[model samples]
Target: MHDRFARSEWFRNDRFGLFMHWGAYAVPARGEWVRSYEHIGTDDYQQYVDAFRPDSFDADAWADAAARAGMKYAVLTAKHHDGFCLFDSELTDYSTMHNGFGVDVVAEFLRAFRARGIRVGLYYSLVDWHHPDFPVAGDPYHPDRDKPTAEGIDGHEPDFDRYLDYLHGQVRELCTNYGDLDLLWFDFSYGDLKGEAWRATELVRMVRELQPNVLIDNRLEGSGGEKGSIITAHPSEYAGDFASPEQVIPVRGLADETGEPIPWEACITLNNHWGYHAFDHDWKPAKLVVRTLVECVSKGGNLLLNVGPDARGRFPEKAVEILREVGDWLADNGESVYGAGAAELPKPEWGRYTERDGTIYAHVLEERVGPVALDEIDQESIASVRLVRDGAALGMAKAWMAEGNPGLALVPIGPDEAFSYPLPDPVDTVLAITRRSAPEG
Candidate 1:
């Protein structure tokens, strides 16, 4: 195991977390990338900065929602690609403190989440569009990228070194001011702007010096679309502590060249956008969210589900409802997720498998016609089988119907040897299977 993996032991065990994408973009309610996507100039975008006051913003409420949803940790956007800082930074006047929103959003978030015993993390964007030194012309995802010169956006003679200093300074502030961050989520790296372009080694060294135990994402060397050198045998100094796969889950969890499992977390949005989009009502149901969380754990990965709060600084009613429903399911079946990882057994046709210690949790996503087949599991090795929701014991025996299949370990759905259609929990009916103890020498 890599030295960093030891530091990420807690992270690996934390199967689910909340990713908050709240920022000035929330004011527009279009999306987090509204400025760049709409090609809105800084002068036009200033409207959001001026109107950015989340009167109903309650950090405690946010933390409460996260806690109720079974989230063990959370990551909030301290600064996004638009160059707006949610915290009070002495180095820049373009922060929440200077923009009439007197509250230090980052500080409140940290205090509230920490009070609730949830590990806190901050997301800082490497690409700053509002900074004059940050090149705009010819830069993809920049509002003024199509302009003639790199300085066309702000025309300040583009000094990238100056921008680097500011970037490093802000990071230093975050590390110093925040009590103790559990993680630091960097936005991305693309084209020629990776690794040394951000002086990643020095930055990582500073972060480590300030907060030794904090976990970092691989975006300093790669983006959400790329896994970076962390997956290789020899990773760079800034290869990060874990691979962050965004928007989509990996078919199989991340692994190195040696086929050994590596730490990873999938960041997925609840709706179509990371920031609140009033028009995008296409929300993922609680069932899909629950199954996705199970899938990630079954593949030896964590899920950092996103919640984009609206401009009013409130979680959407639908989002809250879905989270509550997911929390309800977890309230009963959390044992199958928390501290669980990929089981030694193969993925079942009916559902997924997650194991911890001698216990294997079978997540029955689909209903079986007969008795639920425990494929590849030997009947002799089984110690006990019981429903995770309730401690009700489930009988394990070879049914008369399965006379031809002698090797298959079958567990009845209820009292009888046959399955009762429409599972008690349709989303995920978890069954805890305990392995028999080994014989003494």
Candidate 2:
């Protein structure tokens, strides 16, 4: 069923997503850090802009990599401050279409992603430094502060209404042109003028009317808003269709150590830097990436890992290589992740478990020496127990029926081979174990 803006299945089942933070600003190679690094000076940053040319930018290639990585959706920055648009916008001359890149970035990405069966989401920042109608202390050519230039209805030389018209036109273009967008994630919502709420509401409403099932993020709300809220009010007052926890996944799963409701996602970058910084070679090992995903899903959260491409729009060689390694792991063990619920394992000196379809997938976090003990769960419910990693079958070594601690033990077959073998690295080792008769009441 549908939950307001997003499908419940999409919210729960999609355990992985790819987040792309790309814009004209990435041209500097120092990353989007140029916004603060150059200290809001347009003329100074323009040097990097003029030299920005992505000759090898290929949307299809990026989309293909994402698909191979097992990402269900990809979110791209439609426009990040510095006022440059990735899509063809009627509002500004500083866009990919007008720039040397002379291509509709969003349109091309949408086509590539859709062809690869990946859903598309756009990230649009609320602040625009280029617009003259945008309130500022200095010349309209550039705002001194990086914050959005508030709209002043009565006191601006350039028509403020025209700016809103431009915003609306571009938003309409985004929703309609993208063919059924999945998300319009807005950023920087704490500051918007009085009517901004209405404007945002109308914009999102218009988008929903067009797509009928599009989802909008909460930043569109004035101070307490989500996209469905009345014009620019903050959507916090309303429960968003889904909670988007950024940067960090809860240390434990969705619930804190004390069990509570918290749907979240961990948006971590492959390296220390988000955008490709030529000097930043540090990449999170595939093992770390896999472990992070396990921790997230164990807590009822999705892992929306981010990978910043170079200005040429190609996945950095480091990122691509690591992704392929992770993909191989996922290809072999995806069933334990996709369409699964937060793990509920008994106090195990050895492993953690993820459950789906009346089966408990034991992800061996630790390998015990002699025997594996499973307590509390009814033994009659366990149809067959096996070790999945190396195709070794586990035979029932012992079982005891006690009212308090009903127990079963599984022993490794070919103990000579198993004993000598090393356990899977720090990464969680997933072992698929089917239940006997589906846990009887």
- For TM-score, the strongest prediction is 1
lDDT of 2: 0.65
Q: Pick the candidate with the highest lDDT.
A: 1
1-441: candidate 1 lDDT, tens digit per residue: 566589989888888999999988998899999998998778899999989988999999999999999999999999999999999999888988988988899999999999999999999999998988887766888888766555556666778889999999999999999889999999879998999999999999999999999999999998986988998889899999889999898998888988989999999999889998999999999999999999999999999999999987999999999999999999999988888999988999999999987699999999887688898897778889999998889887564655887767898786677546668799999999998898999
List, residue by residue over 86-117, the lDDT tens digit for candidate 2: 88877677887876768888899999999988
| lDDT per model vs. reference | 0.91, 0.65
Give per-residue lDDT, candidate 2, residue 412.
45
- TM-scores, in order shown? 0.98, 0.82
Decoy 2 TM-score against native = 0.82
Q: How many clashes show up in model 1?
A: 0
